[model samples]
Target: MDHIEGEPCQDIEDCRLTDRHVQTLLNREADELARHFTGTFSPETVRDCVEDSYTHLAATARIRTHLPVLAARFARQRLEATAKNQGATMSDEPEVLFVCVHNAGRSQMAAALLDHHAAGRVTVRSAGSAPADTINPAVIEAMNEIGLDLTKEFPKPLTTEAVQAADVVITMGCGDACPIFPGKRYLDWQLDDPAGKDVDQVRPIRDEIDRRVRTLLDELVPSNA
Candidate 1:
């Protein structure tokens, strides 16, 4: 669903996160990384990367069920890429492209969250496989709940240039719509479509997205910077 559509949901529950949940997710992720990098990298490196990845995502994610697996996969891909590109001179800024069917809801929200949380550390963009005319209204309200104004954000069509420019290309159930480029990281987020859901339903989706976005930013623009 585009951000231009949807009804606001009242009686929104206060979404709070807990420390145990975060630690558990990280532990699983670290285990996943260990399996992949056991002999290639030291345990300390794997543990540190796993913790960083979890910290980045857990802060904003509202849904915890699949977070650990997602975090592990994401962290693994990033670590692999970083290892491959060691000693290479990379751009100071990392560009991430978020894509979905309409570019109205998920992609827009993800882009905005990354930008908001990154604070100029990352270059964020969003586009749709089939572009929509306006932002989803329900999505706008959901973001507004967190003091993020997405009224100015509009749906954009996917472009070769945009995809090529991105250091990472993330698709939210967009299927095979996004083009494949060599040496670029790609991820597909299996998220629910917010088309017919009310603002209440959208809230949790938004929160979960924020968590993923935060985690992505941590990887792209490290805390040390």
Candidate 2:
């Protein structure tokens, strides 16, 4: 059997350590790990990303030699993502903000598809030049066909804040109403507004958006995925 030293379990019976004890041990372990975790990390990156990793370490700290390996993996991933973001003016990943007259149909569908396919590799936002009452029914139906969920998403208004927040702003038939700002990148996707289109027509629009989404992912993200 393996032998280890240091503190033992408290009055809690099972293997779970006492809360206070864990917190104290966590602070010590964090200090120990700092020697390796620091350096070359991005200043803009949030500290919680590295600090929170040690919160559960008290239970495993008896053999802390294993932590350096895990810390290396975490540090590498965080550093790479930070590096990819440093080159961009807005989002760490290419943030594509989709806008239309009402954010119910075209823009919502585009954003949802991209988020589904790209996941962590891409940042996506969708809003309307003028907010809509609710998401279009047909749009939800079409998206459900592909197993994408938009339950938590809602129509948001276009504003200087939202546009400036994005790396790429795509407008779909929003006319001149779309927010414009100096030095902000823009694209007008002439996708036939899906507001009242039949399922057949909207299907093609979804397909085209998917293709563009894939291409954008290839260019912006490190992987072909």
Candidate 3:
């Protein structure tokens, strides 16, 4: 589904962020560096900061990305910096996506890992270019060892729209079936799939994904400035 659209902002009543308004104009985003501050600033504080930061950033630079929200984040540091000066008004965290041949293994693990580490600081989702009927049983077993519940999640089909909706698109060997759009950065992870593997084998893969997920989270959205 399209996350945000080009709807004109009509006062605060229309300011909750709709798909239409969010994509309409490419305003100069505020220059704030999120990396400068970290360690659980209150939600209200972050929201305000992100808003003010985006305002300044929208005014300053041109973001290059097919997805509007995704593009908006490259300038995320700029927005955070602006908000910090004003004392904190961060709003909205970036969205992350994971992809693999089957949404059942690698992608699923990666998404869960990111979400677990980030708490509610980031939004995480995963899908397949070609989906499976359900997530891999072995993968699920491995994650459960760490106490994450994926019972409500399901395998989903991949769409260009979904990829465009993400700030980052991580592909686990999904070469050609996945298209490359302009203004998008791509990361190819060379990980083995655990679709038919036993829990012993799957455990190592799960641990690796979690480690990578934690590193990516820090590098991309560090809590400590």
TM-score: model 2 vs. ground truth: 0.57
Q: Please identify model 1 stretches exceeding 4 Å from their true place.
A: 1-91
Residues 1-225, candidate 1: write the lDDT tens digits. 211113221212222223567567677678767877766777677777666554444433444455556556546655654553553235568889899998889999998998899888887778888656567789999999999999755555566656776789999988899989898999988888877788999999999998888888878878996
Ranking by lDDT: 1, 3, 2
lDDT of 3 at 170: 87
**Predicted model with the maximum lDDT:** 1
* Steric overlap count per candidate: 12, 0, 44
lDDT of 3 by residue, 113-145 (tens): 898889888867777776664578888888889
Better of 2 and 3 by TM-score: 3
Candidate 1 contains a number of clashing pairs equal to 12
What digit string (tens of lDDT, one per residue) describes model 2 on residues 1-225? 222334421221322323465445444544544454355443323234434333222232333434333433333334433543454333446677888987888899889988888887777777777656467777777788889876545565555545765777888889987667676688888887777786776788888888887776676685833
For lDDT, candidate 1 versus 2, the one ahead is 1
Candidate closest to the true structure, highest TM-score: 1
Each prediction's TM-score versus the true structure: 0.60, 0.57, 0.59
